[model samples]
Target: MIKELLEAKETDSFDELCVRLGNFLGIGKAVPPKVLLRAIDDPPFADNLIVCRNTPGFLQSLFDDPKTAQYDGDAGKKKEDGKSNTELIAKAATAFLKWGKAGFSTVDEATLERRENACLACPNLSEPKNKLQKLVAVKLDKERVGRRTGDKTCKICGCNVARKIKLPGESCPDSHPAIEGMTRWNEPQRVAAAVAE
Candidate 1:
């Protein structure tokens, strides 16, 4: 469904795409056309659209009531507690500091895929909860190295998983659930230290 919509983007007008999306989601009259168009064009919302296609009823919920959309799709799934705005800011600041320390260099393709795969399998991956977080997610989405459909924000560290995985300096906030001492995307030294500890 999302692939069809993306292909439609090549041939459909802005208004046409909005109507198609609304009709596809079965909420043609519920959401305004402009809002639907915005969702198609905006990164955070667009990503949600992709997610919605994969998870039934999510698109409707996202369009109907964005406030609860975060919880709607994963009602039965186990999710970690989300960070507060203050905590999110602190984490982002720390991540930037680490990135700066490493000269903002990106990891090689193999390393990037390894990190992204880890995030894809992690349960902490989640959707943007608010407009501010959506905006931040958009910026990070642009820097993404891999274009996987499962890409989303990391609930633990409040970074977009797709983008964070590519940064050489960034490390996973939590250890891999099955890997004992292994952090998902830690630098080699950090991994060694974690294993030692």
Candidate 2:
């Protein structure tokens, strides 16, 4: 099914492809970029599948001018020193919390609703079949504070979209610059007074 979707050629844009995959997954919405990339990065899907052989380049072409080809490539490749994704999510969580401690609050109701709607429309909002169980069970606790692993998690940050989207400074981590605007956030600030206006 995935192969057919990729080869269909009717799904011209990344969002369109995501919608197709999401529909296939019964998600009825677009999947996050990270989730889509993970599909291309994993072994059975990309390494052995004939249709996904050139998925990386194919995804790259979806963007008019991608900021970094790295985004369209495999996501499972180890970074230098082989830091696990759990460690990476933890680090990002810490940074976000620190920003919170610096007096940031959740976004206004309108913004929160808009962002949440966007997340609800994302396929990555749901858990993946090949989810990183260990990490999902442990490190993602902060992000999943009010949600479960099988629920909505941002494939990029592994954060629950419900919580993250409500935050005043949260934003989508999608690599394609245009699609990254699912939500808006205030710049980093040290005082509450300087938060979103």
RMSD of each: 14.9, 18.5
Q: Evaluate model 1: give its lDDT.
A: 0.49
lDDT of 1 by residue, 1-197 (tens): 22323334333443455455554444543345434433422434443443344344655555555533433323301121454434433432332233223333578999887887777777888986654345434333434547562337888766666656665656778876556656865433265453222
- Steric collisions counted per model: 0, 2
Error of 2 at 171 (Å): 1.1
What is the lDDT for 161 in model 2? 52
Who wins the lDDT comparison?
A: 1
Per-residue C-alpha lDDT of model 2 across residues 1-197, encoded as one tens digit per residue? 34325342421455555554444343446645554444433312221122222344433333222322344434333421355544434332332233323222466666655565556555556553332212222234334423323345667655545545554554565433243323223222234342221
How high is the CA lDDT of each candidate model?
0.49, 0.40
Deviation of model 2 at 169, angstroms: 1.8
Residue-level error in angstroms, candidate 1, position 74: 40
Give the clashing residue pairs of candidate 2, or none: 30-123, 31-123
